[model samples]
Target chain A: MAYSGFRLIREALTGHKGWKPAWRDPEPQAHYDVVVVGGGGHGLATAHYLAKNFGKTRIAVLEKGWIGGGNVGRNTTIIRSNYLLPGNEPFYELSLQLWEGLEQDLNYNAMVSQRGIMNLFHTDAQRDAFRRRGNSMILHGSDAELLDREGVKREAPFLNFDNARFPIKGALMHRRGGTVRHDAVAWGYARSADRYGVDIIQNCEVTGFKIENGKIRGVETSRGTIGAEKVGVAVAGSSGKVMSYAGLRLPIESHVLQAFVSEGLKPMIPGVITFGAGHFYVSQSDKGGLVFGGDIDGYNTYAQRGNLPVVEDVCEGGMAIMPMIGRTRLLRMWGGIMDMSMDGSPIIDRTPIEGLYFNGGWCYGGFKATPASGLTFAHLLATGGPHATAEALRFDRFEKGLMIDEKGAGAQPNLH
Target chain B: MIIPHPLLGPRDAQEFVYLGDASLLDRPDWQHPEAGSAYYEYLYLRDNPAGVHRELWFHEQGDRSWLVVTRDTTTHEILSAELASQVALSKEPVR
Candidate 1:
């Protein structure tokens, strides 16, 4: 399949005529049906779905940078519905289903790979946890396998058997989980949404929201003030500040998550392996480099730079799992800021602010949830109620003490 | 010492070190003991072969690193190896 995400973006950067729409009306518009902030994946998807499902075609997606320049372009690109939580599982499952049909839906190939994701378990307690997680997925109509020690060896024989340390045991495998070309997914949505008549305005930063009598009228942007009946805050990392300008405080924290890639080698790993006991996960990209990541930088900061300890720790994990990789040199690393919610799940709902909608608090799993998130967030925007699966992600759930804590572990104050 | 399972190929006992039972690895800071186990498991395969062949005793208690003395399981042939070179720490006895 043609991975034209970079190609399209390059075309836009070269001052392509079709890069943006010329405003027929130079002055501020009286009102638009909808205005979306942040032309990243979620914003574009929202505009696309809004037009497709709700007949709301008069929409504007204002981006501060080039489209998809945010976390949409910076993620590790893993996609799966292996969640065991209540609200997260079904919504992600819908996303996985959409991902399977994305090529046909958008007429664009995203290079979606269902190569599987395996979570290794070292202790009996961890194994038991995996068993429960597997069972949970099965109960929810998703595929999950609980592999024993011999099964683990069969799946990944390269693992070290004994030295004087942690033993090789079993793993929980989600065969439907895999990766996609992240930038392609974004560009596919942008192009498809543009075809649907959604105006994608680049270099347009939302300076402040225009509200009157407790209802949002539109947004004032760097380009110019645009009027809209409804406004959606789809900005992920910059969400808090955007909503703050509207006099709203959200339960969201911004943190940086780092990902690393090693120099290209012949493909050694065919699937994703997550170190459940340790804070690391790795997979080999089609380009032959070993791609991996770890937990978010514990501190609260928007700077997309991480400390060296996490990088070293994640690399050490790769070497421990596959000894041959110790010889591979790391090429480069980058970080993306994430908007982590208190409950570690996304919040996509109508806020208390009249005519203002939100789709933030994606944590690290937003890439996988793009399709379903857009579909459902649009549903709420048009109908004023959440899509069935997104009911738990409402902003009111936090105050009502009804957080959908899927990890079972209490929300990590340090984590999202 | 029998090779653990189907995944591991049968090599001469001379390739290993017997450091004794896994005791030195029983700490939380060396990373959760489970992590230690996973690390050592990978170490056995990647490290260059040394010590006696058959019967290896691993001693993990002293400095949290393994000390293996390898000997042939059948003939008790002592192999040429020591614990000094495998780890960064010294195995010298402290007064």
Candidate 2:
């Protein structure tokens, strides 16, 4: 009789009487329709779309740290849709389209600069490879141009066209690829989602899964247990540990990818350029800082301490391209954990576990696919159906021998 | 032949010059008077001869300076390798 009376009081005071949860108790209860794990760009975008598209209000995005505190905030902020694989090509193209309209869509300035991206070729074989890649992009309606020596020189006249170490021969340029402000993307999504009444729970860690009868009931978090019919894990770097609670092991290698920025200088580098032979890519930030990055730490590590050798190699490549950058000083360096998959692709599909879904394995390219990833992930979660463009990216493809290897000869991530 | 193009880096640019005979380097290595540097390599171009005869080149990316190289145009063999100091890779600090 007392328990029944307490239940009656709880039901009556839920929203009307301002019943509060234990975490925010003494204030008022905060209930949500859906619970999203990981408050990075993907999670935040997911909540935002859920509210906008489906009118699914009362969504809560729980983050162990501040919003965008994971790989989303630490990435290089490259935005491109130069994928060559079958299923991934169209899907990423959609992302590129979304990026084109991002400023107006979010009503925030993401600095979506489409300066362009060039992949320099050093050998005949490398040139042929770019040719094929360009053809692939062209097939998908993407603007990929094959530039010869004169063409390359016209684009980057400062390059050492005569020097022979890593000679500037020709290049493959994706005219649509560029960059964005990584932090602004996160905050914009957070604010937009917050405006939709989605709870942004920072410093709330999900400790375990609440499973009952082979179905997800809620999540056990550091704050407390929250009941929900479905759960989505959008964590990138720490995705493995979170999914492990459901006895699942994904094909992901956690490594720290570091990026560095040089002191502010005049605009020199006209576009983001990459050396095909070496592990180096560079672009001048709008702040006049030359931003660049190279290969990962090449080992499994969650720590963000980056080694110096890679940094040196990347800078060396940069100097080879533009000798004038010698006066620039390195401002700061940072490292972010990347969940690199075997093929350097992402997995955005529902898991075998009922009521649980996952959208991760972005490798080092998550920043570019933020909007499309969230849209597709939510679509798959709501309908239990994968998009035709991402059908080949099922988690079980690893076991089914249906790998969508895009690099043709070298599909392995290490080779990439 | 292959020679380096300075001003780039340790691995930047190389100039491939095709010549008639492989007896070019036998005379004497011509060191650039400006930069006080001397180094070069000579090689031959084997197949697909679009030019008249052999080839001579320079490898400027080696050891920080360019190499004024001469090579056999037909066989693509190195004939003479001379260092050219006209091109300096870079003296500035990389960020």
Best by lDDT: 1
Residue-level error in angstroms, candidate 1, position A233: 0.8
lDDT of 1 at A177: 91
> Could you estimate the TM-score for every candidate?
0.75, 0.74
Per-candidate TM-score, first chain only? Answer: 0.91, 0.89
Full-model lDDT for every candidate: 0.72, 0.70
Which portions of model 2 show Cα errors greater than 4 Å? Answer: A1-31, A408-416, B1-95
Error of 1 at A315 (Å): 1.7
Worst ten in a row by lDDT for model 1 chain A: A21-30
Choose the strongest candidate by TM-score.
1
lDDT per residue, candidate 2, A14-112, as tens digits? 853543321221111244457889989999888878877767866788888887678877877888877777778888888889889877777667899
Error of 1 at A321 (Å): 2.3
Instruction: Write the residue-wise lDDT of candidate 1 on A220-282 in tens digits.
Output: 898778898899899887776688788776666566789988899886687888885567788
